[model samples]
Structure formats: C-alpha cells, structure tokens
Target: MEISLILNNELVWDKEFKSCKEYVSNLKSLAPNEVKMREMEAKFLNLVNTDKDVSKYYKIGGALCISLLTNTTFAYADTLGGVSDKLKTIVSPLIELLAGLGYPVTYGMLITGFIMVIMGKKSKGIDIIKWACIGYVGLQFVPFILNILELIGRELRNSL
Candidate 1:
C-alpha cells in the first residue's frame, strides 16, 4: 500500500497509493495553475530514476513556485542559475581528478560505485556495507578485468 521513493539517496516521499492510474490522474489535475510545480515534480521523479541529486531540483522548483506566487521573475532568475552552478561545482572537482588520472574509466566506475553505495546506505540503513561491496565488485572488478584484456590486446598489436 505504501510506495517509497528514494531521491538522491534520501526518502523524499513515502505514502500509500491506491492505484497508479489514479495517482497519475491526480497529478494531471494539478498541472493547470501550478504547471511549474508539476514540472519540478516530474523532473524530480526523473532524476530519482537516473540516480541524480534531487535537492537541486527541489530548490529550483521551490524558487519557481515562489516566483509564480509573487509575479516576480527577476528575483528567482539567478536562483535557477545558482542551482546549475552549484551542480557544476559539485561535479567539476571529481571530473578534474578523473582527468588528471589519465584512466578516467576507473574513476567513472568508482563514481558509479559511490553513488550506488550512497543509495544503498539510504535505503537499507547501516547495512550498506554489503551493497557497497557488491557495487565495488560489479563496477570496479569487472572493469579491471576488461582493462587487463585491453592491455593484452595492445601488447599483441604491438608485436604484430
């Protein structure tokens, strides 16, 4: 009866849903006056599916709602930009580190592992160690094996 939605590794909404169609119909009904709110909610849902940070979406959506209520666009214009800027700042450091390593594949795998670990921790409580271990094995170990094969291929090419 209760549907739980984990957004950005945090529990955003957990409530009972009678039926999926009914829920969607209710959402559609809310779209007329609060179109921005609906847009933000939909975006938030999509971000959750993609394992992205939903906090940024919440901030942007909140700001947009305030703008709609007050008939003031200028005040929240920079706020929307700020959300994007903050996201860039958050990702830039990791990207730079990955670039510096020259083996971005490993870094990308590590990032995926980290995100999975975070999500596991949030959803499953303190027992996230098991989830993290699984993620590491799947992401890191699989790629490491592939990298070894790639190295062997390069060596064979050089010999030929």
Candidate 2:
C-alpha cells in the first residue's frame, strides 16, 4: 500500500511500502556498486564538461563547495574577530559621531529647503530638498550595503 507522511495539513512525502521495516530498509540500502558509481560519475563529468551552460553551473557549484569547505574552519574566523575588535575600537566612535551629526544635518537641510521654497526660491530649494531626502534614504542603506559587500568579499576570498 502507499504510505504518506502529512505535516501541517500537507502531504510531505508519499511512497509505496509494505511495512515500516521495509521503508527503513529501503532508506538504508542507498549504496551503489563502486564500478557503476564510477561510470555514472564519469558520464556526469563528461556531460558537464561538454555543455557550456552545464559547465558554468558545475563551476558555480564547485566554487560554492570550495567556499563552504574552506570556511568550515574557525581558526581564520577567530583572527578576523580579533581584527574586527581592533577596528571597532578605532571606528566605532567615528561612526557614532557621524550618526549623531547626520540626522540634524538632514533635518536642517530639509527645513532650510522648505523655507527657501516658501520664500519663492523654488528651483534651488527643490534641488536641496531632493538631495537631502536622497541622502537620508542612502544613509539608511549604508549598513545593508556594507553587509552585502562584506558577504561578497568573504565568498570571493573563500573561493580563491
């Protein structure tokens, strides 16, 4: 009979089995003969090497595998943590100073721009307001952008 695994009102898995032991046995018997496995591996490699798109995907998969394997060691990460601690000691105060100043600058520019526009100096006022708004939004994204760049750099370093 068919066996089904349901979870949260969804069919998670469905298979045919005579008994629970048979299901467990089938799961355990996943090994293939060495000669057949080698032949299949060779065939897969040949296919990947011969096809440009497949080769690109294979290279990407290989790079990901290499990155994952290289980053599994904590020794390098501990050194980075030490460096980051040093950098934080130096840069954290500077960052806080800038953040403390940025909001007032943003508000000042916005208020001045609106006042100018209300006084009929429309063109320059609108330009200043637009730039101030853009700067405010851009400042919010700085941390997100830095995080993305850091992730990219780490992956590139690992792949290399």
Candidate 3:
C-alpha cells in the first residue's frame, strides 16, 4: 500500500511527537507491549508487499524524508545509488591508505614481537603480536563487514 494511503487510514504511523506534552498525551494510546507494536509493523509490511506500486511509493517516501530532513527537494528514484557513489569517492582515499600501510605495519609489528620474544620479553612480544593480528584483520575485514551490512539493509528494503 502507498504510505500516504496507509497514513491517511491510520495516523499512528504519522504521529510525530510535537512536544513533551504531546508525547505524554500520546503515551496513553501507545501499544501496551512490543508485540502489539510489531503487529502494526507487520501489517505495514504486508500492505507494501501486496502493493504493485510500492517502489514508486518508496521513492516518494524517501524523497519526502530527505526533503524534510535537509530542507530541500530530493525525490530522485536513484538517490541511493547517488549516495553510494559519493560515499565511494569519499572513502577511496582511506581505503588506499589502509592498503598501503596495513601490510607494512602488520609485518613490522610481527617482526618486533618476534625480536622481543627472542630477547626473553615473552609477555610483551605476545601482546604486540596479538594487537598486530587484530589490527591487520580489522583493516582487511572492514569492507567485508560493510558488504554484509549493505546486503542486510537491501533485504530489509526489498521486504518492505
């Protein structure tokens, strides 16, 4: 179902708190438990799934939210792609720097830890090696983690 159509039928989805006073008043109408609130959410998901034009509705909803938040018109259907491209541009330098530095730093740490261990500072060497391993994995694994998160978000959006 179109978001506006649903909102027109039930104001709960459109209920934005205007003030502490309004929030207090609305509290009385709130679902008693998380399950009740989730049932409403399920109804929304079902409606969107049954609606043939849900994608168009999503574009309008996304635009409206972006416009409201930024105080500007932003109704483009390709907004997500545009944002992703911009993000890649912004993050490219950081990724390049990480690729350049991570390997050398990791190797250096490992070598230093080995030297320390050979000099009988076993505890310090092990600590250094542990930190180096963690840092190297984190540096290399960030993109994979982000990919997983993006997949999850996409699935949720598609479900809607």
Candidate 4:
C-alpha cells in the first residue's frame, strides 16, 4: 500500500509501507535524531502558535518588510521566487497609502534638521530640533494607531 505525507506544501514522503507503526519504528531506529528534531520543532511551533503577541509581531514584521521592499522598488516578488504579482501590488499600495497618511512628516522633520545645520542656522536649528523630538515622540503613537487601523481594514476587506 502506498502512503503519502505532505509538509510545507511539498510531498515529503510517498512510498509503499507495510504498516504505519512499522514505518515509524523503522524511522525511529534509522534516524533517532530526526524524530527528536521533529518533536522539538513541533514544540516550538506550538509555543509560537499559543503566544498571541509573538504571532502578531511575526505577521506585522512580515507585512512591514514586504511593504518596505515594495515601496523601495526592490524585486521582492522575484526574491521570494515569484510570489503572486497581485500580492506584490497590494503591499506596494498599502505601504504608499500608510506613508501618505503622515509618515513623511517624520522624515521631513529629520531632513529639515539636517538642512538647518548645513545652512549655518545654528540658533534657528532649535525649531528643527524641537520638531524632530516631537516627531520621534509621535512615532510611538503612530504605529499603534496604524496597526489597529490596518487590522480593521484587513478584516473589512476579508469580509467583503
């Protein structure tokens, strides 16, 4: 009888076997380390799955990286071995929209500070300094609000 097992969307095993138990026992005898490694992997996966904050960070980080790559005109799709063009396009626009909302203000302040220093406006640079400080402080709030809104938008889009 032939049995098959798929892992990570790949056909990892497909062969004739007398019995599942025998196959397992043979695997255990032949590759004890493999079994132990698989068990450890499963435990780690379970831990990640149970941790809501960790999962959220993973999702957000992945989305942010993809967005950053797309916005910066990098070949993110090709790098990932050609992920769907639609997904690449979607991430690019979402990143642009988020940036358009207010992100540029933060960068603008930093640029202004640099320009003020270069223009020999040592005393007037205080204003740019203050703006940079405010922008840094505002960053803490911006990410939280944007994350919440992104979540809501994703939910609404999925619902539709």
Model 4 segments beyond 4 Å from truth? Answer: 1-123
Per-residue lDDT over 1-160 for candidate 1, one digit per residue giving the tens place of the 0 to 100 score? 8889999999999988678899899898877657888899888678867764566776678888998998887533455336756876798788567545544554465556567667765444333445545554565465468568767876776687
Clash count (model 3, backbone only): 1
Q: Give lDDT: candidate 2, residue 28.
A: 80
How close is every model to the real structure, measured as TM-score?
0.18, 0.47, 0.46, 0.25
List pairs with backbone clashes in candidate 4.
none
Tens-digit lDDT track of model 2 for 70-154: 8752233456646866887799889878867778999999999999999999998999999999998898888789879878877
Clashes of each: 0, 0, 1, 0
Pairs that collide in candidate 3 are 1-47
Candidate 2: regions farther than 4 A off: 1-85
lDDT minimum window of 10 residues, candidate 1: 121-130
In model 2, pairs of residues that clash are none
**If the candidates were sorted by their lDDT against the true structure, best first, what order would they fall in?**
2, 3, 4, 1
Model 3: per-residue Cα lDDT over 1-160, one tens digit each: 2232255566544333367777688888874888888999898788778886985697679888988998996434566746877888999998899778999999999999999999999999999999999999898888899889988987787787
